[model samples]
Target: MPRIELRTEIKAIKEVVFDLSRSIDLHKISTEHTNETAIAGTTSGLIGMNESVTWRAKHFGIYQNLTSKITEFDRPNYFSDEMVSGAFSEFKHEHHFEDSNDGTLMIDLFDYKSPLGVLGKLADKIFLEKYMTDLLTERNRIVKEYAESDKWKQVLTK
Candidate 1:
């Protein structure tokens, strides 16, 4: 498995950041480049513990569907989602948030294993890791943007 860890500092309340992190709407917006959409299961709002979402998206020029469930969640603190079915053999993402002197500290721990065994490992070493890291970075950037501004209201207030 490959793991990617990221930390983002946002000037916002932990509650707001936590909610924004779980908002499906915000996820769609952040991944617009990949045309990501939640086709079923909590498609539009915050996804909580035991909730699942099936997402369809274009990745590497191909459209793929992935279903993942929130296995663990603690409001305003942390949450972890794991893949139920997807292209990858394994996928687990943990989102953690903490109150900081300036604002909130958001941390992401992404772990994944690709299919095809050896070939997958090679791909991960060659490019998959960087690609996934970039994707997470962009997602966190969007989260930071929303958390720091009133834009979060658009997705969180409803």
Candidate 2:
């Protein structure tokens, strides 16, 4: 399994950061590599503790329907989601938010493993590791950008 951790400071409300992190629609806004569509449960609204949802997404040129369960959730503080069923052998992600002097400090922790046992290791060494990391990095960058913008400010006000 590969674990990826990223942290960023954003000039935004903690609630906003937390909310955006759990928003299915915002997931779409944050990445181009993954085309995600919400298929079940509430998709466009705020998600709270213990919420579960299903999404169909295309990744690595393969379409997979993933069902996620919210394992941990604390409003404006932290939340975690784990894949119940999906393409990967294991998938889990945690998002944390803290009140900072400037605004919010956000941290993302991702852990996942490829499907094939030995073959996955080889694939990871060749390109999958870097590719996946880069994709997550881009997702964080885009989310951070969006969260710090006036558009997100408007979203919070609504």
Candidate 3:
């Protein structure tokens, strides 16, 4: 299993960051062309403690459905989701938020193991890990932009 952790400083409050991060609709908006829909559980709303959801999304043009359950939730601080069913053997994502003097300090911890033992590790070392990291970085940028934009707030509010 490969555990990836990324930290970023966000110029926002904990609540704002948490709200934006927990917003599945906002994620859909940020991802833009992602053909993903919430199929079950607390998919569209703010994910709370023990909430779970299944998502059907097109990844690299291939349609896939993954089910993830919220194993831990502590608003404005930390939350975690564990894969119930998906392509990987096991997957868990933990999001941590801390309020700093300047802004919010966010940390994303992703741990996943592939079904293909040695080959999976090789693939990850070669490209998958970096690709995933890049994806998360881009996603964070989108989130930061949206969260900081008044226009985005207006759109969501309306």
* Total clashes in model 2, counting residue pairs 3 or more apart in sequence or in different chains: 0
**Candidate order, TM-score descending:** 1, 3, 2
Candidate 1: where is the Cα deviation over 4 Å? none
Q: For residues 69-144, what per-residue lDDT tens digits would candidate 3 score against the true structure?
A: 8898888799998999988889998999998887788899999987789998998899888967876777678767
Return the TM-score for candidate 2, rounded to 2 decimals.
0.87
- By TM-score, the better pick of 2 and 3 is 3
Report the C-alpha lDDT of model 2 over 23-87, residue by residue, as the tens digit.
66666676545777778865766666777788887877888898888999888798999988877
lDDT of 1 by residue, 1-158 (tens): 89999999999999999999999999999999999999989899899999999999999999999999999999989999999999999999999999999999999999999999999999999999999999999999999998898999999889
Native-vs-model 2 lDDT? 0.79
Q: Relative to the unseen true structure, what is the Cα RMSD of model 1?
A: 0.6
TM-score: the better of candidates 1 and 2? 1
Clash pairs, candidate 2, are none
**lDDT measured at residue 20 in model 3 versus the true structure, 0 to 100:** 77
The TM-scores, one per candidate, come to 0.99, 0.87, 0.89
